[model samples]
Target: MDAAPLAARVTRIATLVAGLPALPPDDGSRYSPRRLTVSWLLEAESVHTEIAHARDLGAFLDWCNRERLDPLTARPTDLAQFKVWRGAGTGGTPAAASTVARALASISSWYTHLVANTDGGVTRNPVAAVKRPPVNRHTSTTAGLTLDEVDALLAAADAQAGARAAAAGRTPTGQARYLAALRDRALLRLLADLGLRISEALDRDLGDLSNNAGHRTLRFVGKGGVHRERPLTPHSLQALDEYLAARAAAAGTTADRLSGPIFATTGAGGDGRLAEPNIFMTLRRLARIAGIASADRLSPHSLRHAFATGAREAGIALEDVQDAMGHADPRTTRRYDRDRHNLDRDPAFVLGARRASRRSGNQR
Candidate 1:
């Protein structure tokens, strides 16, 4: 947690808040945008938000340092080089376009913020100066699990949970691991069925899920603190029930059984809310255990993608898919619609039996 070199520059910038010597239009662009990005984001209350912003900022800084480039003097050519470096191989495998797109967006937003807040003193976004890598949102091959794969994952989770429960002993460590297995099963099933973001899945209290007349639903705050409710699928509800039973057994006595996170940490933290990174680790491990082909790409978001895609394939309307996935924009949901984009499974080919029959009759 030691302060970065930019820390000193930011401290100096704070001093110049009131009456600073203004930069001349052409030649006075000497302050590093790298320093400005770190300071600006950290100062704008973004430190408490998504950590990806800081990660992207740090990566950009590292890229600049390695290239012997000054952020203040970076041009369109430098931006293009960064894009190439970001998209191409580390070990003969290219990075995902989505990842490069996010990093570019972070850098672009940093420059835009500087331009706006600094009275256009920093006039240009270097990212805007170059062509960004094309993100093929409509073409996501490894974007999600198939429905059978999702079911297989859930089955694997259940089998593992049963095994752990059977082997669990009186020892604290053994009990915690057993409980963690149970929790992971429920968590994975929830995400797989509900199409929830990791943040939404993790940010839940015990009371968030409620049952009425044998129908169950979850009410929780989503992005932008928007409160939303989604009906629970039967499999998700059953998995949840099993999880709660296991949770009670894991709670022992000292742990509160009724309040706090629905998916609490059963590992070293013991009843503390499980963090997002751990959720990711759990999903990855589960995906590997389930023998998923694209285990590396299987994340909580991937499960969400699976849910949306599977729903679309089942003949659900586009708007319904959007509503179920809690997407404010249909366009966002469209990206998750792998079935819609899958030309090989086109209805024109699959459902053209009458045309085939007519051709056969004419030939006869």
Candidate 2:
């Protein structure tokens, strides 16, 4: 197969995908007017998906070039071959169903858009005929803590702060860690109650906490650099108040140290906002102190999962959960709702299974 023709087509597709006007078709050969239209339509529709769509689309085009098949003449077998190649195991890890699905869907959409605009370049989407690989949403391991565990962790943080207060030393090292523990207690509460991502929580400044009309709120930029202001829960407010007061006192009576980041560096080194790694290491140490099972299994995200899960079980609205978590899509929130993941919740287990009158029941 000639790589030059394929490279030209890929280049045209790339140019359009980058939201640039297409270069004038080269002197050699040109794609149909309908194909160009389809490319732009796919581009317009894929803005929300961004680079992931571009990547999947590029892979499919490369595969089509390797097979020497145009969309106009591409058969169902060609689509199947692409799927097999993409879904093959990497090292020992199997390619995720979600990954395979994305690739197939991108190719399928391209063909679909072309078919919609074309007279006869393509008759049908080959992907439409093939069964989509199943993505089991329940298989995710986004774990949450039970309320008792949550209580224990928070209590452990408070206990550590108290212990550190009593263990005051002349050296700044001990006091720095002590202040850090106080910060960690507050951080844990924010994550467990407010449902903040670690980055969102850490990126907050001192001024982000404000009150309006008797309601306290915390402001931060979420994913996609979208700023969000959520009213503080009572529990979270109380924790924040205690933490902030402790933080202020820990940094001395001066107001300068309190001017910036809500979570400043402590524990003997580093400054100007606590990094995510510091937060993680702090949580790990706190988790061990709290007697939680494994270091690797527990994370700040677990607290977030706990927040969402606990809210769901307490009957908070799903949209409320989405907004509070700063999820871009409600479907993403639904995925985080672990309520349906439990095997015991299935209808296969009836609460009371009657023997159905042993005399009348016939054995299979």
lDDT of each: 0.73, 0.70
Best-fitting candidate, measured by lDDT? 1
Clashing pairs in 2: none
CA error at residue 128 for candidate 2, angstroms = 19
Model 2 C-alpha lDDT per residue in residues 1-364, reported as the tens digit of each score: 1365347545656565444222223333235633454354445422234345566766766666676666456688878888887898458777788899988887777777767665675688889887779987544555556777888888888898888876645567777767777778888888887878887887677878777778888877777767788788777677667666656666565433566678877644333677677777877777777787764477788788777778878879989898889887877787767665667655556533334444346653
lDDT of prediction 2 = 0.70
Model 1 earns a TM-score of 0.73
